[model samples]
Target chain A: MIDNLILGFQTALTPQNLLWCFVGVLAGTVIGLLPGLGSTTGVAVLLPLTLDFEPVTALIMLAGIYYGAQYGGTITSVLLSTPGEASSVVTTLDGYQMARRGRAGAALSIAAIGSFVAAIFSLILLMVLAPPFANFALKFGPVENLSIMILGLATIVSFSGESRIRGLAMASAGLLLATVGMDAATGTARFTFDNVNLLSGVPFVEVMIGLFAVGEVMYQIRVGAAAPIRTRFRELLITRSELRRSIGPIGRGSVLGFLLGCLPGSGSTLASFIAYGVEKRVSRNRSQLGQGAIEGVASPESANNAAANANFVPTLTLGIPGGGTTAVLLGAFTIYGLQPGPLLFQSQPKLVWGLLVSFFIGNVMLLVLNLPMAPIFAQMLRIPYAYLYPIILFTSFVGAYSIDNNMFSVWIVFVAGVAGYFMKLYDLPMAPLVLGLVIGPLFEKALTQTSALGDGDLLIVLSHPIALVVLALAVLLAAGPSLVRLLPRNTPDREREPAGV
Target chain B: MSTLIRIRGNGEATVYAMLALVGLAAAVSGAFYGVFVDGGRVGPGFLPLVAGGLTAVLCGWLALRGVHGRRSHPPGGPADGVEPHLAEDINPVDDATDDDVDISGRTRRERIHNLWKVFGLTLGAILLVQVVGFLAAFGALVFVISTWIERQPLLKSAVIAAAATGLIYGVFGLFLEIPLPGGLLGLGTEG
Candidate 1:
């Protein structure tokens, strides 16, 4: 291990390697900040540029882009309620709420801090436990995966604000919307209504841009922001109490993100969502979550960064892609004339360690770059609503068009924006709907796989300990709260206490 | 009949009813696809059957709750119960007309009018994309929005519109090379 660290340091600390790392992260931040682009697309587009470089150096740079985008994606989510990708969608729930209440700087700052802490924590785990985690990841089959998706469904209860029923209805609508495309198993189109674009289902990214950015901008215009949120420089900085409060969520988020992220196909997006749900279930400031708690900003942001790092574990150790970006990064590895797997680690220790080490260095650079800029980015809110919204509208439309170079996405944005406006008017939560849309496909695939493996019995999971344990967790998550409420209270005072609070 | 009338008139109840209708349609379609089309396998319709059925029942329940709550509470003021659809943060002390009005002194009607105007203009711009091209159409959107609705100076609005268009050009047109459409005017195409 000591020799490996020395070799890793030797490889990563070279002038060219460090320079490329910095360049990669800088490019990644820009790519991620744009509304339509994300880590997978960014790394794919830039892969050819690094083909001439050495394998270790090129992998280091590409890896930087992957993790750095996780940091950049949060910027827009906090400031604009425009998630650069699905992973940051949860951040919009509280981060934008914080910005509206004049704390964009604090929201962005804690995200950066939590992200920095999470990346370091996950990287150490990645370096030490890659082989073991990869083996464990293989144990998570269709049955276990189905249970996790069920667990995700149970977490929708967390996204419900004052009204649980309304949230569930929205989630149902979202799930129905998600089933619009072709059925992977049957090769049958369910709800496409004969439109070619609907065959791919409603694009999640465009829907996010519409429902959050365009919808939010239009709502602000109608309701009228009293003025731009103005704050002093001192107030723009995160308060000490805010950081202290974030400590628990950051720790919890890191663990949840790492565990989920280690599983191939779960990705940082699911990790972030599940992490936020866990925080809502356990945090002391749970009630403040939808209304802009600092823990809200910290938990999901930390989880995504941790998950982004953990994504590499399965990719490096098993030669299996962990998520979309890692899939592209794995492609880059093949392009660089390197084979990835258990044996490759022994053959290519320098490359693997160097890349892992570069994740650490690149994240440190992102923290340095993002921390002070958090307040600077918040200064954008000072631009008056009238002028700013037009610009945001322009971006929203053009960004939609750019996503697939299709006019259909633009229409989706407009309709979703209108829907979003109505939702705001009715005080309906959007988070649960987005979650339903995200996990809908995964849920269906898992169901099909489990049924196939079980020969339609669906009880094969009972025979597998891991699957059984996971399904039990799902059942507990879904039904435990209600059962606990049914428990008898021992004290007369407690029993007599108002159920209102 | 009275409950039906009340539900139609109540925004909260009406929204839930609409959602319930959608859910019902989805559930029926899902059942059709699963049993008739796919022969009852756990295929595409399985999730929709579950989710859509859940949505229909739950939304039906919520719609009833909305109507009962509104009926129990009169619509006049704070002396009455909470308004069914008003945002939680909103104070019901204001007059009914002002329920959705802005503190900026803009009437509800005026704001809704403005919202329609913007929506129409954007919708028009998107339709005009093949003819006038995305750049010109969006530029006009910015110009009209800033000047007509926001009441900015015409010259300033034009400049803002141009700058906004230019930024779009630089980002989508040049850097990303998105192949933005250039229609009759033949402008702003990276290709």
Candidate 2:
């Protein structure tokens, strides 16, 4: 492991790789500061640019964007009271209060420090756990893989907002969309409609660009933009006492966030919310929570960054994405002709290790980049949406058009964008759709493989202990919400915020 | 039935009904491609058929529930309309402002206008790109959207559009070597 780590660092430290990492995180920070754009859009829109780069470097840059956005979200959450990302929403609760009380600098500083600490902690945990998880996953056959994929899809549906029915429908829609091309098993056209473009199926990247980037741009156009709040800069140095107060919250939040992040369907947003809730209940300074408590900013900040980093575990080791951003990364993996799963660890150890090592360096870069530069990035909020939306639309068009150099792909993006807008309007979660699309082919492949292995017995899944257990868990997870609603309530539940990217 | 339909509301019921129809169509098409084969080999359409069937069933259930929910409500009492899970009041990334606007708040004309302005420009750009080339089409899109929709100054719009076009041309066309469509302008090599 040590030797691998050394090799990873050696690859990551190359001048070209390091340069792209810097550019990626820098771009990530800028995008993160913009209220309308999050890591998912940033990664999706920027993915095409990396098509010509080395696979490892491209992955590194994408990872940098992923984690860098975590740090960027804190700036607006603390200073403007508007979270740049959904995961940072909790930070705004107390973070804005701190800013209002003239401790904006302290709030921002603690968030940066806590995020740095937590990211490192999660990365360390990822290093230790991912290898063993990948090794264990290597033993999973088609039956188990199908079961695991079922579990993943079920978790995503269950956790996607309030309407499990709608979520399931969206997942089904995604799965239907995935079956649009020539069937790999039998060379038969399923839903090509005699169009040559449909013969290859929908380009996943174009779908991503359409749903996330173009849809967002259109939404922004309808809802006018707001001016960013300006706050006076103060010393960014955290006081010793504040640091002391944050230590426990940071430690607890990191572990909690990393664990939650590893779970399918529970992304950083939920992790931050849970971490903040935990801190409020247990902190010695609970009275100050929601009223400028430094711990308020610390805990969620740390948890979100930790969660963001920990999200990579399932993505890399199991080929399951926990959220939208990782889904884009998964698509990128396919684009690079590499399948991410247990085999990826062995087949492309250099790419995998290089990416992991880049996380270490990327976090350091984010820390160094964010501490002083956050205030500057916040100024980016003033870039008028008048200019921003046009740029976003143009870039989205280019991205879609670049995929097949065909106008058909571009048209798909526009159509998908309209569909995405309506889905959002109807409160349908987009993450599950993306998750279903990315996982659909895999699910189909696994199902067919399992059926073949079982020799036409549908109950073959039950014969495998692990597959049976996983399917059982999937059933429980899918039903858990309804079951909970039926149970007698002792106390009124707290209003849970909707999940976001 | 009239009361139930009234309570369910036309908009909500129609959306669900449309979804069911689409799902049914998907299922039919999928079945046409063969859902299963000999020796229990799952055909290409097997998963799609399942997905389509599930969608049809689930959406059909939702449509029924929408009407049933209205029927279950007491007369003269507030109808518990079938509400999809509304996202919380917190501002999302795309919507950073505090306005709580919804489609219901706008007149049909207003809604159509907004939709047309946004989608029209986008679709126009898509169609125009193949005719005039990407840069020219994109420039026109930016200018029209910024000036007409956003109501920015014409000069500012032009500058922004020009900058956007340049960036797209340089990055995607030149740097990445992606052969963007040149159309009539012939600025870009045919991809």
Candidate 3:
């Protein structure tokens, strides 16, 4: 393990890998700070640039974007009240409130520090735990693999958000969409209205960009833009009392985040929500919640960043992507003609270790890039709405076009954007739709493989221990959200100021 | 039913009904797929069938919930009608100003109109791609988005559009070598 760490450091420290990592982090920060452009879009847009580099360097760069964007996302959430990504939604509750209260500087700084600390801690955990987890992958057969995939699909249940029926519907739609391409098992066309492109299935990244980024941007545009509120750049440090308040939550979040990060289906997003939820649970001082609690910003921020790095554990060790972005990273592995499993450690030790080591370095780099720039991003709110919206639209188009170099993909962004806006207006959860889109194919393909093995007996899903345990987990995942809602409603009218612009 | 619907009240209830109807249609479509298709016990349509039925149930639930909300809080009180914060507000200030104005005039029609425009713009962009190609389609769409949706001044919008088109051409077409549709203006032709 020590040797692996040293080896990873050596590979990550090289000039080429470092350079790409820098580029990835830099681009990620800017894109993340921008509204309607999340880390996914940032990665998708820049994916073309990585094609020329070595697979390790490219992976490191993309990984940098993934983590850096998580850090950068808080900038908009803190300064302008606009959540740069879904994870930042909780951040805006306190972060933007902090800005309104003239503690924007402190909010921005703690967020950066919190992100850095969680990321570093999570990376260390990744180094220690990934090998064992990957080894555990050896235990998984076709039945277990299929069950794990089913468990991932079951996450749509968790995201149901006041409506299990809608959540199930969205997840099913995603599964149907997933079945579009030519059937790998029987060579039968499943649902591809025989359009050649449909024969290959819809690109997951394209669908994601459409659902989250484009749909979000259209919503923002229709709502019209806000002038970023300017605040006096006072002390940038957290107060002693504020620091004292944050320490417990941050500490709790670090531990909680690492655990959730270890899970296959739950990764950073769930970790953030759970961290925030737990902080609320543990708090004795109730008034601090809806009214600019520093812990509110720190807990989720740390968890999400940590979870972002932690998700690599499953991907690196077991060849399973616990989340959408990691799934794309997995695609990178296959693209390079290498599978990501225990064999990867034996055959491509440098790449595996280098990627892990680079994450630590990237987290540090992200803090340095973000802390001072937080206030500046807040000032992006100062930019007139006229200039900002055009730039937003322009970036969306550029990002879309860059994906496959085809205009059809770009058009999909607009169409999805429009569809998503309505979905949002109707109070549908976008994440389930996206999560479904992402995990659907994996579930379908795994189910097909299991059935092909003549494990069609529905009882097999219950009889196999791992499958049974996972099915139990699926039931729990389905129930967790309702339990959360039923939990004593903290505040009937929690004064939620919409994150600025 | 009409009396109940009327008691459910105006534009808001109508929107809910429309959404419920859409959900019902989707449910029917999904049920048809599930009932008809059978390759194995677990066919391809099973999931969709489940999703559609679930969606229909949820939509019905939502409509009922809306009705309940209306009943619980009758029209015209503080608890009734739309809350102040939730009210449709749209501020039509095109010029970006530092002075933050309360531009909160988002209307039901305006929201719907934007959706229609989005549908049109997307389909248009796809069609335009085949005719004039990526750059042209992109430029036109960006131009339309900037000038129309955003209501930017003509000159500013044009400059943004031109610069955006050029940047895309430079990065994607030249640097990345992704080969965006050249349309009538092939790569060799000088702009």
Candidate 4:
């Protein structure tokens, strides 16, 4: 293992691979700082170009974008009250409030520090636990995979903000969308409507870009752009007491974030949301939570960053995507003709270790780039949305059209943008819809594969101990909160919707 | 009918009716594709069939909820109860006010007018995309949307349009090397 790590470092230290990694991380930061654009889009847009590079270099670059974007989300959430990604939604609750209260500096400082700490902690944890985790994952079969997906689907309830019924409806809608395209088991088209693209199903990247970026831009235009409040560069740093208040939450969030991140299909966004919920519940200074609590900023900043890096475990070792961003990374791996999984570790030791080492370097590089540049990014807020929206719209078209050099993708983006805007206006959360779009096919495929393996008997899925345990854990993940709420003396309080929905 | 009152008592009751109408549209669209047969016994339409049925049920549920005045209830009490239209933040009376004021209900007409203008801008851009191509269409789009705000002068609008097109074309096309569509009068195909 030590030799492998040293070899990985030696390979990644090459000038070309290191340069590509830097470029990926830099682009990721810029893309992430912008509201609406996210890690998925960043990876998707670059995936085409990365195809021409060496496999290890491409993997290293993609990994940089994955973690770089996580760091970038803090910029927008803290300064603009708009989240760059779902994970940073928690950051907006207190970070924006702190900005409004003239303590933007403290919030920015704490967020940067928290992110750095959490990222380092999660990286170490990943290094320590990855081999064992990979070994355990090798035992998984189609039945266990199906059960795990079912558990994931069940957790969709936790995201039902303000209205349980609405959340359920959204989740159901997601499931229905997932069922689109061809049925992999029977080789039958499900909902193609005669379009060739539909045969493969709705492009997950296109759908996500439409829901998050294009849709968000259109919504912003409809609401009218607000004039930004100006601030000095010196005003973006934290003081002694602020730093002290942040430490405890950051520590707790790091632990929680790493655990949640290790779970396949769960990533930084869930980690941040759960972290914030737990912090609010436990904190004695609850009143300060929504009103600019530094702990709020620290908790999610730490958790999301921790989760972002920790997610690599599943992607690198288990060959499963730990989240949407990792899925894109996995897709990139496949595009380069390399499969990701425990088997890959043995087959492509240099590629695997090189990518892993690059992550540690990327984390340190991101901290250096982000912390000192907080004021610079915050200054970006002064540029009115009128000026910014056009760039966003133009990029939407360029990015969409670039997929296949086709106008059809661009048209799809526009329509999806309009649809997304309406969804926002109607107060529907877009994340669940996105989750359904990405995870839907995987879930259906697993179910079909498992059932087929059982020779038409569904009961065979329960026979495997590993599969049973995973499914049980997934069930616990889905129902644990509700069950805890139902416990004696623990009446669930009215669930408050997380900010930046 | 009496229970189904507006919460803020501002918008037409037809808002709920409109939601029902959209729901009906979804159901109708789903129904059309639900029976489009394919190879399998279940076929391609099975999922859409279930989806359409679910939509109808959920839409019906939402309509029923609206009719029961569930959404009509104000923050303090039931619907139809008399209360100040302005937010407590603006009133400076309630402790809940703090600093955040809800000004969304205000400037309604201006917002609506701007929306219509934006719709006009979008339509014009789509038309332009066909006539001139992507570059010129995008430039024209920036001008139209900016002009819709009514604050910027005509010359400023043109300048903004030029800048927008230049930045997009220059950065994404020239720098990032994305193969953006060059219109009828673009610099060159090499771009």
TM-score of each: 0.70, 0.90, 0.84, 0.81
How well does candidate 3 match the true structure in TM-score terms? 0.84
Over 4 Å off, model 4? A40-63, A161-165, A227-233, A284-287, A316-320, A327-338, A488-501, B1-69, B72-109, B112-130, B150-191
Q: Identify the runs in model 2 with alpha carbons over 4 angstroms from their true place.
A: A235-245, A280-293, A486-488, A493-501, B1-16, B63-89, B92-115
- Which window of ten consecutive residues has the lowest lDDT sum in model 1 chain A? A492-501
lDDT of 2 by residue, A317-401 (tens): 9888877788889989989999989888899989999999999898899888888866677778777776787788888888877
lDDT, candidate 4, A114-196, per-residue tens = 98899889988887788676677677777876776565545444534334344445545665676667766556675567888
DockQ of 3: 0.20
The residue-by-residue lDDT of candidate 3 on A1-501, one tens digit each, is 989989999999999989988888887776777776777666655666677678999999998888888877787777777666656766777887788888878887888888888888888888888787667777777677777766665664564333455556555556555656765554455455557666767776666666666666666654554446464446477788888887777777777778776666554666776677677668655468647889988998998888888877767776666666776677667656788765677789899999988988887788887776666656665655545544455556656666666566776676677666656545455555555665666665666556545535545566578778987887787777566555565565443321110
Residue-wise C-alpha lDDT for candidate 1, range B77-117, written one tens digit per residue:
11001113221222232233645655446675677678788
Q: For each model in turn, which proportion of the native inter-chain contacts is also found? A: 0.38, 0.42, 0.16, 0.13
Off by over 4 Å in 1: A1-119, A122-131, A158-162, A226-363, A370-375, A487-501, B36-40, B70-112, B188-191
Error of 3 at A3 (Å): 2.7
Q: Whose TM-score is greatest here?
A: 2
Residue A97 in model 2: lDDT: 80
| Candidate 2 DockQ, CA atoms | 0.32
Please state how well chain A of candidate 3 matches the true chain A, as a TM-score: 0.90
Ranked by lDDT, the better of candidates 2 and 4 is 2
Error of 1 at A432 (Å): 3.0
DockQ of each: 0.28, 0.32, 0.20, 0.16
